[model samples]
Target: MKLSSADIARYVASDISDGSYVNLGIGMPMLVSDYIPEEREFILHTENGMLGMGPAAAEGEEDWDIVNAGKQAVSILQGGSYFHHADSFAMIRGGHIDISILGAYEVAANGDIANWLIPGPRPPAVGGAMDLVAGAKQVWVMLSSHVSKNGEPKVVESCALPLTGVGCVNRIYSDLAIIDITADGPLVTAMMEGLKREDLQAKTGAILNFVPKCEILKSFKNEA
Candidate 1:
C-alpha cells in the first residue's frame, strides 16, 4: 500500500537534521510541523512574517492573529516573534533557511519544480516558492502521490508545467518514495513498503537509480 499524506509528512520530519532552520510551504508541507521529533529543535519560518512557528493550534485555542503563510491558525513557540513581510522575505532571500519543504504539481528529474499553477481555470499564484527555491540551501518537495489523478507520473524527465525554479529541488518526499535529485538523475533512497525497485521505475517517467541498501519506508503511527 502507498503511504498516506500524514505518513509522508512524518518521514520528511524524521529526515530533517536537528537545529536546522526550515521553511514549510503551504498545504501538505505544513503538516510536517505536527510530526517533528520532540527531542529535535527546529526553527520554523513562515513567509507571512512569523518565526519559531509551532504546530497547528488545538480547536478553540486558535489565536486568530497567529497564522502561517497558509492563513491557518497555528501555535507559536515560546521564543516566537513576528515582523513585517519585508523582513520575512529578507530573511528568506538572505539564505537563512536551511531547507524548504514545498508541495508541487510536477518535479523534473533534474530538480526543477512547477507547483504554483496547473492548466486549469484558477489564476496562477507563485507565492514565495521562487524566493524559497533560490534562497534555501536545500529544497525538498512533498507530494501526496507519485502519479497524477489520470495516472500520469509526476516525477518525469522534465516538468510539463511552467517552471517555478530550475534545477532547485534537492529531494522529493512523495507517498511512494524519497528521491534525491542528483547530477546523474533521480535516486531512490527509500521506498514504500510492498513496492519493488522495478515497480517504482515503471511509474516514474525518468530513469531511477537506487542505493545499494535502499531503506523500506514504514508507517510511523506505531512508533513510540
Candidate 2:
C-alpha cells in the first residue's frame, strides 16, 4: 500500500536526531512536526518569522497571526520566540539549521534538486527553498516514488525541471523508499514492506542497487 501523508511524515520524523533544529518545508514536510515526540527536543523553524514552532493548531485554536512559512496555522512551544522575517531568514542563510526537510519535484542521482518550478507558464513562487538547501547542514527531500500523472520517475538520472540547488540533497524520503545520494550514486537505503528491488527499479529513471540487506523503514517516532 502507498504511504499516507501522515505515514510519510512519520518516516521523515525518524531521521531527525534529538535536539536538532529543523525547518519543515511546505506541504507534507509541515506534517512532520505533528509526529515528532515531545521529548525529542526538536526546534522547528519556519521562514516566516517563527521559531520553536509547534504542531498545527487544533480546530478553533489557531492564532491566525501565528503560522509557518506556508501561512498554515501552527502552535508555538514553550520558550519559542518570534522574530523579524529578516532575522528568521538570517538564521536560515547563516547556516544555523541542522536539517531542512523539503518536498521535491525531481532529484537527480548527484543530489541536485528541482523543486521550485516545472518550466511552464505557471505562476511560480520561489519561497525559501533555495536558501534552505544552501544553508542547512543537510537537505532531505520528501516526495512520492514516482510522478503520479505520467508514472514517470521523480528520482532521475538528471532533473528535467529547473534546478533549486546543485548537489544539495543528502537524503530522500519517498512513498516507496528511502534513498541516500552518496558520493558514488543514489543508494536505495530502505523501502516499504512487500516492495521489491525490481518494482523500485521499474519506477525509477536512475539506477538502483539492492544492497543485499537494504533496511526496511518503520515509524516509531510517535512512541516515547
Worst 10 residues of 2 by lDDT: 215-224
Query: Candidate 1: TM-score?
Result: 0.94
Question: How do the predictions measure up, each by TM-score?
Answer: 0.94, 0.91
| Candidate 1 lDDT score relative to the true structure | 0.91
RMSD of 1: 1.6
Off by over 4 Å in 2: 218-224
Relative to the true structure, how large is the alpha-carbon lDDT of every model?
0.91, 0.85
Per residue, candidate 1 scores C-alpha lDDT tens digits across 133-220 of 9889999999899999999999999988988899999999988999999999999999988899999999998999999998999876
Measured with C-alpha atoms, the lDDT of residue 96 in candidate 1 is 85
State the displacement of the C-alpha of residue 157, model 2, in Å, after optimal TM-score superposition: 0.5
Model 1 misplacement above 4 A = 221-224
Q: Write the per-residue lDDT of candidate 2 for residues 1-224, one digit (tens) a residue.
A: 56667778888887788999999888778788777866688899988887789877899888899988888788898989999978988888898999999999899999999999976788987989999999899999989545556798999999889999999999988888888999888888788778878988888889876566887765444557
Q: List the residue pairs that clash in candidate 1.
A: none
